[model samples]
Target: MTVATDTLQAVEAVFAERIEAATALGGSWALFDRDGVVASGGAGIASLDPARPAPGPDTLFRIASCTKSFTAAALLLLRDRGLLDLDATARSFVPEFVPEIPGDLEVDPTVRMLMTMSGGLPTDDPWADREESMTREEFSATLAAGIRCASVPGTGFEYSNLGYAVLGQIIERVSGVAFTDFVTHEFIEPLGLDMRFELSAEEAVPYATGHRRVEGNGWLALPFTGPGVFSAIGGLFASVTSLAAWGSWLAEASTGAERGPLSAASRREMQQLMRVAPKRHTPPALPGAPTPPSPVVYGYGFGLFVEFDDRFGAIVSHSGGYPGFSAHMRWHAASGLGVVAFENATYARVSQGAELALAIVLDAADRVAPVSPSPAPWPATLEASVALSGLVNDWSDVAASAVLATNVGLDVPYDERRATIEAAWAAVGGRTAASRTPVDAECDSPDHLVWFLPGATGRLRVEVRMTPLAEPLAQTFLVKVESPEPSVA
Candidate 1:
C-alpha cells in the first residue's frame, strides 16, 4: 500500500514541528508500509559541540527500551530451536534468579511473564537506565541477594528492567554466547540491518549525540553506556530507515507466511496483548459537544505495546527513553502502515509526533479510497455479488436459488423475501442502471461483502455472507434503504 504524496509531506511537517517542540538536538522520521520505508526526513543538528548537520534516515541513535523487542525475539528463536520454554521459570536457566516475594507466594515468575512486563518487578526507569553497564557477576550477585518485588510473581503489570536482565542471562546460558552477539547474529544479520549494541568508533557512520536540557539553559551531551548484562533490557542503536524496515516486517506478519530468524506466528505473538495495563483518566463529557472517540486501551506484549482504538483498530508500538535519547515505532496492524522516529534528547516524547503523523496518513487514505478489511475479496464472492445485483434489478426464482444458499428460502418464504427486496429497491428510485450497479463495495472477509446502490431519492445498502462449504453460496443477505438527506431551502 502507498500513501499519497501530500500525506507524506504532512508527515514531514509533523517531525519538523516535533523537533522544535520537543527541544531535541536532532530528529529523524520515516513512513513505512508492508513494502518498506516510502518516505523519510530529518531536522535539527546531530551534535552541538562538533557542529554536525541534521541526521538523515541513516543516522544512528540509541533506541533504549526498543531493544527489549529484540531481546524478546531472540528468546523466541531459541524456543523455536527447542532450546527453551516460555512457560518455564526464570530459575530454570539462571539459577541465580531468586528475587524476594511475599511469604504466601509459591513460585517464581515464568519467562513469559517477564517478557510481558507482568513479572511483578518494580517499574525502574532512570534507575535501571544507569545500570546498563552492570557486570555479569554484579547482576548475578544482585539477583542472589533477593531484590524486592512490587507485586507477586505473575500477578501484575510493572515495567522491570531487572526482569529483562535475568532474561539476558537465560539467553547466555542457553545459547552459550553473549546477549548482544546472539541478537546480532540471529536477528540483525539475518535481516541485513546495521543496528549495533554500541556505536563503533571504527565504523564510518553518522551518529547522533544524545542531549538533555540543563535547568532551562542549554542542551548537555550525555555519555553513552557500554554493553553488559542489562544490555538486553535496552542497548541497541538504530536508524530511522532500518527501524522502519524492522517495524514493517513485524506488522506484515499477519499478511503473509512465516520467515526464518523468527516465524510470522511468533512475530505476531510478540504483538498480542499479554497483560492489560491500567487505564488513563478521561475528561468529562461536555453538553453540546460531539462525543469523544473511544479511549485507547493499553496492554503489554512480549516487549511491545498493543493499543486498541475505536477508530483505528489494533496498533502495535514501543517507545524508548534513556538519559539522552528517545525513540518510538508504531504501526496500524489493519493497514500495515506505520511510523518510526528518533530524537537525540532525553524523554523527548517523539511518540506524540509519530501518532499524529500516522493519523494524518490513515485519514488521507480513507479519503483516497475505503481501506479494504483484507487485501482483496475472493473471486467467487465477487461473482456472487454480481448475481445478487442482477436478482435485485429483476427478481428470478432460479437465479436467486443459484446465487443464495438453501437456507435463504427456508428462513423466509420466497414470496415474503421477494416483496422485501422489491420494496427496498423501489424506494431507491426503482433500480435505474446506476441504482442497480454496486458502488463503494468492500469486504469484511473474502466471503463477506458490503456495497451501496445509488438512486434519486435514496440509496440501498446491501450485505451478504457466504457459507463455509466447498462451493460456497450466500447464506445470509441484508438490504436497507437509506434515504437521501433533505435539501436546505
Candidate 2:
C-alpha cells in the first residue's frame, strides 16, 4: 500500500506537534506499516554526552518493560519447539518460582501465568528496573527465599517484572542459552532489528540518556545501565527505526502473512487478549485538550496489551519505563499501522504521546480513504450475501432459506426489511452493487461483510453479519441510506 507524500507529512507533523507539546528533552518517532518504516524522524538531542549529538532517527532508547514482549516471543518460540509446556507449573521449570502464598499454600502458577502477567506476584517496577543485572544464581536464591503475592496464581492481571524474569530463566533452562542470547539470535538478528539489551560505549553513540526533568529549569542526565539478568523483562534498547521493523512484523504476521522468524499464526496467537487488566479510574478528556489516551480497559497478551476500540479494532501496545527512560510502541491490527516513540525523561508518559499520535494517524488514513470491513472469510458468507442481496428487490424462499439468519423474521419482519431496503435502493440510484469498503479488514472472528451501493441522495450501505457455522447463517442484515438522517425510513 503506497502512502502518499502528503499523508506522510501530516503524520510527521502530528508526531512533532505531540513531542513539542510534551516538552520532552529529546525524542524520536516513526510511522510503520505492515512491511516496515513508512517514515521516521527525530528532534532535539539524543543524549547530553560530551559530543552532544542531535537526535537521530536511529537513536536507541532503553525500551524498559517493553522487553517483555520479546521475552514472551522467546518463550513462545521455545513452547512451539516442545522444549517445555507453558500450561505446566512454572515451578516445574524454575523450582524457585513456587508461589509464596501465605501459610504454605502452594499455588502452582503455570508458565502461561508468567507470560500473561497473571502470576500472583506483586507489581515491582521500581525494584525490578534496578535488578536488571541480577544473575541466574541471585534470582534463584531470591526465589528460593519465596516472594510476596498480591493474589493467587492465574487469578488476574498484575504487571510483574519478576514473573517475566522467571520466564527468562525458563528460556535459559529450556533452550540451554541465556535469555538475551536466545532473543538476540532467534528474534532480533533474524528480524534484522538493530536491537539489544547490551551496548558497548562505541556502539552506544546514538543511545539516549535517561533524564530527570525539573520544571521551570533543566533536567538531570542519568547514565545508561548496561544489560542485566532481568534484561529479559525490561532491558531492551531500541530505536524507533528498529521498533518499526518489529511492529511491522507483528502487524503483518497477524494477517497470516508468511514471513518472520516465528510463524504468523504463533505471532498472532501471542497477541490474543488472554486477560483483561483492571479498569483504571482515569479522568475524561478535557473539552478542548488534545484527545487524552483512549480510555483503556487494557487486556494482556504474551507481553503486550490488547486494547479493543468499538470504533477501530484490536490495538497491540506496550510501554517501557526505567529510571530515566520511557518508551511506547502501538499498532492497529486492522490497519497494520503503528507509532513508536521514546523519551529520555523518567516516567515520561510517552505512551500517551504515542497514543495521541496513533489517533492522528488513524484520522489521516480515514481522511485519505474512508475504511470498510472486509468480505466475510467463511465460504458460505459470500453465498449468503448473494442470497441476501436478492432480498433487496423482494423476499423469496430461495433467499430466505439460503441466507436469512434463523431469527430474521422474529427480530425484524420481512415486510419492514423489504420496504426499508427497497426505499434505500430507490434513494441510492435504485440499484445495488456490492464492493469492499476501503477500511482495513478487522482482525477478528465474527463473520461479516461490508459494501456500499451508489444512490441518488448519497449511497446505500449494506452490511451482513453471520455466525461461523459450517453452513453459516446471516445473523443480522442491515441496509440503510447514508445521509444526515439517522433513521432507516
Candidate 3:
C-alpha cells in the first residue's frame, strides 16, 4: 500500500492543483492516504449571509447518501452474526414490507436486492407526497404498501433511497434495536468514527449551513431536520477525517488486511460488481455541458459504485447530495489511497472535489516506477512522422477536450478517450523523435503510459494512468529523467 517517494510527490502536486481549482469554484476539500491526511484546501465559509463561523476539518457536514454504505455494512455484519441472510426475501423479516406490484410479476425482492439497489423499488415512494415526520416503522410500512415496482426484482438496477429506508426497518426488526442505535453500536463506535446520525439543536451551532444556488445571487442554506424515517438512507453527518477513516476501514476489509465487525469474505463480496447500471439519462446541460455516462459500470454490492482501474486497481466509491450539502468518498484498495470531499454549499461540488482528489492519487501512482532508459522504437520515415503528426493532432484535440471535460466535471463522451491519449503519444513521439529505443513496456498498457524522453543531459519523462470513472486521470509530465554521471560532478 506504500507508494514510492517520487509517486508521493506527484500525488501531492496533483492534490495541490485540484484543490486550487476547487477553491476557485468556492469549495473546500480534504484528501487522505491510508495512514492519514495528505492535503486540504479552500476557505471554510462561515456563512453565505451576514454572520457565521467558518468550517474546518472537524466541521460536521451532512454525509447524505453516504449513510447507505454504513447501513449496508451494518446489515452485512448482522448477516455474519447468523442473524440475517442476504439472499433471503425481505418478507422473511417483515412480510408487510412487500412491494405493491402485480402478483403475476412474481417479483420477490431479496435482502441483497435492497442492499444493492436492485430491489425494483422506485427511487422514492410514490404515495408519500408529503415529507412529514414519522417513525421508521410507519415509513417502511407506508412505502411497502404504497411504492410501485417499476421493474422485475433483480432485473435492473435503480438507486432507491426508499429501499435503504426499508433496509433500516429490517435492521430494526432483525436486531431488535433502533436503526441509528444499531449503526452506532455495530459500526460507528467500533471504528471510532466521530460521526452522529442526527444533529442536536445545540450541536447544530457548529455545523456548516447547506446552500443552494438562487437566480441572480449565489447560494442559500436549506433547513433540514434530523433523520426520522430515512435515517438509514441519508441521515449521517460527518467530517472529512471521519469519512476517511471509514474509507480506510472499507479498503482494509476488502483486502483482508483488517477484520472489523464484518468478516473478510463478506467484505470482499461487498466490493464485488454485481449489476450493471442502466444508462443514466442525460439531464439538461447544467453550468457545464451534459456529463457523459461514466466509462465504468455500476454495481449493487453494499450500495457502492465499484469499478476496476488499470492503475490503482479496485475502487469503491459513493456520492451524496443533500439540500445544501454534498459529499463523496473514494477508496482504492491496491494503492491504499482514500479521498473524501465535502462542501457545505449544495452546489453539487462534492463529485467535482472527489474527482480532483482522485486525480491527485492516480497522478502519484503514475510516478511509482522510474522511467526506463530505452524508448519505444520509431519508424524511421518522414511519411510516418507526417501520418503520426495528423494522428497526434486529432488525438491531442480529443485528449484536450476529454481532459477539460474531466477537469470541469463533465461526462466523457467515449470510453476510448484515454486509449486515444496514449495512442496519440505513441503516434506522435514514435514517428517524430530523432532516435528511439524500446523501453520497458511493463507499465505500457492500452490505458497507461510510462517512459522516458531522451534529452541532452538526461531525459524528460511523462507518466499517465487511468482513474476510476468517478475521478480524473492521474498523470505526471516533465518528470526529471535521472541518469548516472560518467565519473564527473
lDDT of 1 at 115: 95
Residue-level lDDT of model 3, residues 1-489, one tens digit each, is: 454555444434433444345332233455666566666544546356555566666777888888888888889888888999999998788777767664557678899988888888877633221232468557756755666787788878888887777788889899999889999988889878889877764564456767666768755657766667677777888887888888777766644665568776877777777877763332222222222224344455686877654344456788887767778888765555777877765546456546544654565554664212222322222222232223332445454444432432233333354353344345334333432432443343433455544433444244444444454343322122233322110
Model 3, which residues run further than 4 Å from truth? Answer: 1-27, 49-51, 125-133, 279-294, 347-349, 370-489
TM-scores for every predicted model: 0.79, 0.80, 0.67
Off-target runs (Cα >4 Å) in candidate 1 are 1-6, 51-53, 99-103, 152-156, 200-204, 257-260, 279-295, 370-442, 447-489
lDDT winner between 1 and 3, please give it: 1
* Regions more than 4 Å wrong, model 2: 1-23, 102-105, 202-204, 214-217, 280-297, 371-374, 377-379, 382-489
lDDT of candidate 2 over 103-131, digit per residue (tens): 55778889998899898789988888889
**CA-lDDT, candidates in order:** 0.83, 0.76, 0.61
* TM-score of candidate 2 relative to the true fold: 0.80
Better of 1 and 2 by TM-score: 2
Displacement of residue 30 (Cα, Å) in model 2 is 1.0
lDDT of 1: 0.83
